[model samples]
Target: MRNNIAEMEFLYSQESIATQFSRDKFHQFLQEDMIFPLKGVRKKYSKNEIIIPEGEVTNEIYFIESGNVAATKDGENVINFYAENEIIGLTNLLLDSHSEYAFQVISNELFVTKYDKESIIEKVINTQEGYFYHYVHMQNQVSQMIEKEQLLRLPSEQRISLALLILGTKFGEETNDQDLIGFPKSISKGMIGQYTNLNPNTITNVLQKLQEEEIIYPARRAFYVDIFKLEIKLDQVLKK
Candidate 1:
């Protein structure tokens, strides 16, 4: 693979260097020997493409540059969805084992920077910035895992409510009227079921209830959470 030095920082950029240095200065620093690994490539995938097959040994880690990728376990249950600027396969790199879940491109297309796992680990320890970036990444990963565990312990109705809240927080965009926090686009109920490990029937019922209560607006293609109502419900749950 031809080295794409400048793009490598996207692999684990908690804070982009572009904000700190001029473009030319940033490139100049990267050009120095061993500052960042040059063993990476930029790649793209079409929608529904399998980026990383479950059980496959992943020698490389991917940093998403754009679009969305869904990580799923058992071919249907979603572990999580990753969007632009998030690194995939970091946990796999740390474990040094075959991938526990499959990663698939869910949007029309996906762009990612791929790097060798070993090279990344080496550089991460040698550089303070890299160390801090990886540290934050790991913390975020652990927090998400803990959140998921908490979700799993809730009753299905509360669990679904919390799942929608999580998705809305991650992918929501403010509406023109500022009353709704809608996702970039609609997501299917089946996908929601996959994420929450709830049955299709249960998901449909729960969503219908939420819609009737005006806590959310659900549609066949996608749904939007009522930010105000959602916050109230979340607070209620927290106080329980």
Candidate 2:
């Protein structure tokens, strides 16, 4: 299937080329190539829309604007996500190949941007300026990778807490009722397992214990952490 740029937006843009090259002569070069990808922007997809299959030869790239999309090796195993302000299909663009993971929408409001390889290689990468542009862009990726590695090294429980805490930190705010309220999101046992070494049954038990004592709220695939109580508990756990 063919895809265009408007269909995606950056889900995890550690650094945007636009913002990064704003003051340089590189803006025009990047702009021309960007226009080449969006020759046709398709309507957005609802959740579960299969944007790209795991192993297909495609020249398209996407950028997520809103919502979230997760990539997986099998349909069942999630690899990563394109949340907001990040590029999708980047692996393919850089490697001149296809994805080994399946991408599906996880949020209802996701939007994206798409582009082609020829434009990228020619208009964006062939020139001296193009070389510099890709250099700065790739450097940020190294940093993002390191951050993810540091995160993955933490225990599963900590990883879950960290993801939630990060999500909460940006979207969450303190309440006078002694709770931090942010995006009303959910966490599931299986997801916790993927992020850490926890098993489903153990995840269930820990979640239940937390919920029973009002430490968290586990609802099916969605779970909530009580900030005030959680912080106190985390403090004690960290000390140990």
Candidate 3:
């Protein structure tokens, strides 16, 4: 028994080291091969913290290192949620226009890498990879806008499911058990309702239905939705 346990420990150690090495190599490739050097001032923010207030003229662009942020047009309504590896506040930085939305940290462990627009433009944005990144980001925003419009027309349950799926895709971890995953942090029902323009009671009813169907499992304030099952249900709802 002792020998078996030692073998298991060794295997775990090997796996951990291999994973770390792969991550290191990937980051190194990004910096050297791709010539994409990510240089910024790292910042930490708490939950519900406001990073950029609406109508504020700012020259800083932020890259999310981890955690999630909600972009709100009104103080109470969430227009979009940004997750890890996403960039925000670029429009104000690139153009002279002021921000039309407020950006608030929605996750407790929000880690952001901030860059001064002037410095970035002078140093990075002028480079080839920088231009590519900028173009890709613009395309992504355009697609997101299109998605938001489509979501507005979806039924509340489907909208909520799609929202959760987006969050899971952007910031969730895959599990071995029934392939369950969702946001790493708990999101409030009120926030979800605000994002989907649904009432809390309606959201609750939908959640209960999902739970009954075994499509989702609740964890604290968040739900670990089974992606395959949810997609199937969404398809069924859309067809009907």
Residues 1-240, model 3: lDDT tens digits: 344335434555644534433322322323453354555688999988999999988888787878889999878888888887777876444645588899998777799878777765653444543443444445468878998788878988889888777767667777786468865564678878888888999889988988999988887756687988878887888889
Report per-prediction Cα RMSD to one decimal: 7.0, 8.1, 11.9
| Model 2 per-residue lDDT at 102 | 78
Cα lDDT tens digits, model 1, 69-117, are 8888989888888887777886644645799899998888988878788
Span of ten consecutive residues with least summed lDDT in model 3: 21-30
How many residue pairs clash in each candidate at the backbone level? 2, 23, 0
Task: Compute the lDDT of residue 186 as modeled in candidate 1.
Answer: 33
- lDDT tens string, model 2, 77-118? 655555655666654345447677778876655676566656
Q: Return whichever of 2 and 3 wins on TM-score.
A: 3
lDDT of 2: 0.57
The candidates, ranked best first by TM-score, are 1, 3, 2
194: Cα error in model 1, Å? 1.8
The lDDT for every candidate, in the order shown, is 0.74, 0.57, 0.72
Number of the top candidate by TM-score? 1
Clashing pairs in 3: none
lDDT of 3 at 126: 49
lDDT (C-alpha) at residue 58 in model 1? 84
- Model 1, C-alpha of 112: deviation from truth (Å): 1.1
